[model samples]
Target chain A: MTLAAASHGFLSPTGVEIAFVLVGIATLGAALQTVTSRQLVHAALWLVVALGGVAVEYLLLTAEFIAWVQVLIYVGSVVVLLLFGLMLTKAPIGPSPDADSGNRWAALTVAGASAAALVWVVVDAFRATWIDLDGTVQGSAEVSGRSLFRFWVLPFEALSVLLLAALVGAIVLSRRGGDAKGAAETSAPAAGEERH
Target chain B: MHLAYPAVLAVLLFCTGLYGVLARRNAILVLMSVELMLNAVNLNLVAFDVWLRDALHGGQALTLFTIAVAAAEIGIGLAIVLLVYRNRGSSDIDRLRDLAERPAGPAGAAGSREAQPDTGAEATA
Candidate 1:
């Protein structure tokens, strides 16, 4: 019964596929806005929308655990971190000219070419492939947890260590300039004195 | 759902990120674009995992790992950008061309005229 529908060509669209397309369009639109907006802060805000749309796509794909994580980590924390970075850099409050670099046309050409090539290859490769969502849930939190602990325990532990290293590195990199400033303040002039 | 939908969506999103990375002047915006690219890959992973239904669920697990790594990357990236901003007074990539071969000097008009002949001499040689 289901096998016949699985073989149905492009004309037969399913409910989930329709929803996925809608959300995907919204997500791509937000992503475009994020990149092109002149207002710096607005770009960050648009990023939140794009990330949230990706989360919804995850939900449509039935990966419940990943969807929530995407919400919590990307839309929640990463966007906030980006906002903080923007403010710390003293980015302009409103639109200022020169938001894009001079090489954008070149970039556009390259990106467009790659996108064309990649989309052609991907669509040609997977034209008839259909994902069957009828069986037992694949991405429930319980299933992901069991698999993480059982088959993926080693890499999971290693990731924790990498997180720790990054935490310490961020702190050290952020705080590094203060001590060097005073020493450089004294030695810089001394070195100039020697040079002259 | 047909696999081509997610695959094509991911391709488009990745290209958008690639454009952002190339075209954006601000470091933070570039980081946002990188996040977009990574999320596109995550969507691909989740979609294929569901399709394959791996007994070990490698696709979904890798997605979790990717999310974590992305979080760490954003943290470290922001820190570095902040440090660069403090040192350079602006986070604009175009202005931070210390390593460029162009010899634009501090003394505006006279400097470039002097530099032009030297570069021209070098170029011809």
Candidate 2:
């Protein structure tokens, strides 16, 4: 099928737009819940929902490769890592009273202002623009890979190194607590033995 | 087909994340908020890339790199938060005012000095 023909067929008033709006709403709601939920676990789960909705939005935009990556990296790994952190740190599983600060009203105001400004600017700038989805498949894995490997290879490799460094840093930080605990344990036994 | 839909969505998501970062007390939740903001950025990148119809797919490519960076950030951020929880038994940012300057005294000097070694060790570790 030709690009223009495909877009013309799909772009007609149909369920796609409705689906996009619905998914967008769901994503926004999930994100709001993720941030506001008091229970740490619930918040994490809600984050998964929000992230998943983003993936769905990607799919709707015909970026299948990016969507799956979103599912795998974000919904698959990051949230799991977050859960691990929550568990290791013993964050409360239930609603936490201290989850909110007293500066919510102020925060809301700032957020509102920034959001309004960003929206206004983006809308004004792109008011007449429309994505020519009828053109080349920009979202395909092949196209994305070519771009990444050809033009963005340096940053891509750098990102890998950054991930490795982060892995090491996380291990070091978590291990420090373990080492301290071990030291306290061993020292307590020695002191007790000496007293005896 | 209008760019406004996704643009508005990204704006809303970004602001919600900003609110979460400023208002949330839990360190982990704050990190989650950061992720939300990053996602908003990704949405904008992809939307613009498509709208511009660039042959290189630079937006999608950058989005991939962003996802990687975000992952790395969360990993390190969570590690620091865990370390804080271990030392203080609480993750309350407000309670972390020990860095603030105290009245000049031997006690204050000793207290600040004592707090430095553990953090240094953790960093080196």
Q: Which predicted model would earn the best TM-score?
A: 1
Off by over 4 Å in 1: A1-6, A176-182, A189-196, B102-125
A26-143 in candidate 1: lDDT tens per residue?
Answer: 9999999999999999999999999999999988888999999999999889999999999988899999687899999999999999999999999988876888887788888999
Q: What lDDT does model 1 reach?
A: 0.88
Please write out the lDDT profile of model 2 over residues A1-196, one tens digit for every residue.
2343345433464465678789999999999998788899999999999999999878777677899999999999999999998897788768888898989899989998998899899888765555555556768888787778888888888888888988998888777436665676464443222222
lDDT of candidates 1 onward, in order: 0.88, 0.82
Pairs that collide, model 2: none
Worst 10 residues of 2 chain B by lDDT: B116-125
Q: Kindly list the per-residue Cα lDDT of model 1 for residues B9-115, writing each as its tens digit.
A: 99999999999999999999999999999999999999999988889899999999999999999999999898677655678888765446556568778876676
lDDT of 2: 0.82
User: lDDT tens string, model 2, B4-61?
Assistant: 7788898999999999999998888899999999999998888888877777788899
Worst 10 residues of 2 chain A by lDDT: A187-196
Question: DockQ winner among the candidates?
Answer: 2
Interface RMSD, prediction 1: 4.7
Task: Give me the runs in candidate 2 sitting further than 4 Å from their true place.
Answer: A1-14, A177-196, B101-125
